[model samples]
Target: SILKKGGIVPVFEPTKATAATLALELPLPSEDGVWTVLYPASAKAANTLEDGLCSRGFVVRRLNTYDTVPATWDTATLTSAQSTDIVTFASPSAVKVWSSRLGTLTPVACIGETSASAAKRIGFDLVRYPDLPGMDGWVNAILEVIESSSSSSLCKHNFKA
Candidate 1:
């Protein structure tokens, strides 16, 4: 949306490495120039984007534009989630919240490595994440977990996020 509004043509890259390669192809600054980037507060701990760009001789100014907060789950929703065959987590915040509220007995499918790591640190025995990124990979990971769990016991094929 920002690129579209700014009339900047975007080269879509699926991974950070690919994006860094693309950034390397960009014209280098005559002098070190600051590139202002608006990012979510949740991702501040992993500033790979800024670090990568900076390494290419571009100064980066990151602005914390937003933050991710856990949503309050109602009693019925929480109960339903607890009974699910698997739980999917997109962010560490979600994993933390779910672990705190429901405990980590059910298996979890995480969207990315970061979330998967968080789940592991939180004492989740069964945590799965795809090598590839994005919703497609995330969904595939969930299905893989579900299939694996089904072999052990009767799985309802129900997943909650």
Candidate 2:
């Protein structure tokens, strides 16, 4: 049991039924330092991830990504994109408090095909989505949209000089 103040919380073997939340099984917790960068602008849920890492005795660093796109591959490289008119969230957690931020403008995009499933579960009516999921997949998708937009812009500019 883990003692906190005057209370005791029993710790169960991770192999137990609570294991349902486990995203993976083979790779166990690491003793090495673990720093996680959370993107898509959800802070409260980030703490849960941080705490989990700390429970494993891992030094964790938390970084927030709230740039142009709702999410990205490189957490550090995730800067604001001025050209972003459409935004996507990686998962439902990213949208945990998104209702307050969804204003009258700006279209919404969702990460991966599975994100659609998440959105449906959360009842998000308007959300654009990517064909694939995860960072690499989402990055490729946003890159595609950027390239298309840039090319379209060039065509419209038609610079002679």
Candidate 3:
């Protein structure tokens, strides 16, 4: 609907889902001012979709979107409790905000490469990103981490290090 009225959608190119959606939705190149619906943005895509669209040659008639706001965390209470086993971050913004409050979270599972990079840059040790790049993949990666941790305890008694 947005494309019909001259709006652009900048999707992440690294994910297969975005490519498939673009193939189905975007129109063929023509002289009609390049009425393309999908513009694949790499890891360094603009902060906002409207900015991404304009950067990629789409004329945004209106821009009414906002970035994700960071939520306040009760760090004092959390610091007294046990360390988190696994922390999942779906976006770079979440990683930024969460890491700033809580120094580092081990066994971190990020939804994509971009989020994983942010978490790692903030000193997260066990950050993992799925190869498939989706919600299911991210969940599976988290499950894998849990399973590995569970099994490691069984051999803790026999470990020399």
Candidate 4:
């Protein structure tokens, strides 16, 4: 809406999902126009699709607009807390943001394929993602993972509808 109404260049995260949205919404290769990407500082590579566009002669510029700082974990608090069953990540950045915070966990659920790939790269043992998209789909995938894993404790927590 912002792009169409106010001529605002869309600023997007570096992810397949964001790329797909941009491709569908925008016409590429404007000689005098610019597309800006707001990405994390720690990422090693540029946004995949945006960089691809630059190669193809589109003017895509990037800004390292954010940083991920893992929250300090307290040993005493964690030791007293109940064990986590499943950790959920909606974006690749979320996986990266939580990397230092996550020590060891099983049966991680990602919202989509891109995020699942990130989780796998981060050494999450069980990375599961929804076949469909969005929050409902991700939740269903998580439920499926929990059912398949046969974790009785998780099933007892009312995750199902």
Model 3 residue 71 lDDT? 66
**Residue by residue across 7-67, what tens digits does model 1's lDDT show?**
9876654443233443555555455556554434444356665677778766666777767
TM-score, every prediction: 0.69, 0.31, 0.57, 0.62
Q: Write the per-residue lDDT of candidate 2 for residues 22-130, one digit (tens) a residue.
A: 2222144454655343323334333544555456544555565443334333533333433334457666555543433443233345665544455556666545555
Worst 10 residues of 4 by lDDT: 37-46
List runs of model 3 lying over 4 Å from the truth: 1-32, 36-64, 75-82, 147-161
Q: Which one is best on TM-score?
A: 1
Selected candidate, larger lDDT, 3 vs 4: 4
Compute the lDDT of residue 27 as modeled in candidate 3.
38
For candidate 2, the lDDT comes to 0.46
Worst 10 residues of 1 by lDDT: 13-22
Sort the predicted structures by TM-score, highest score first. 1, 4, 3, 2
Q: All models: lDDT?
A: 0.72, 0.46, 0.61, 0.65
Flag clash pairs in model 3.
Answer: none
RMSD to native for every prediction? Answer: 5.2, 14.6, 8.4, 5.5
Evaluate model 3: give its TM-score.
0.57
Models ranked on lDDT: 1, 4, 3, 2
TM-score, prediction 1? 0.69
For model 4, the superposed segments whose C-alpha errors exceed 4 Å read 1-26, 29-46, 80-82, 93-105, 151-161
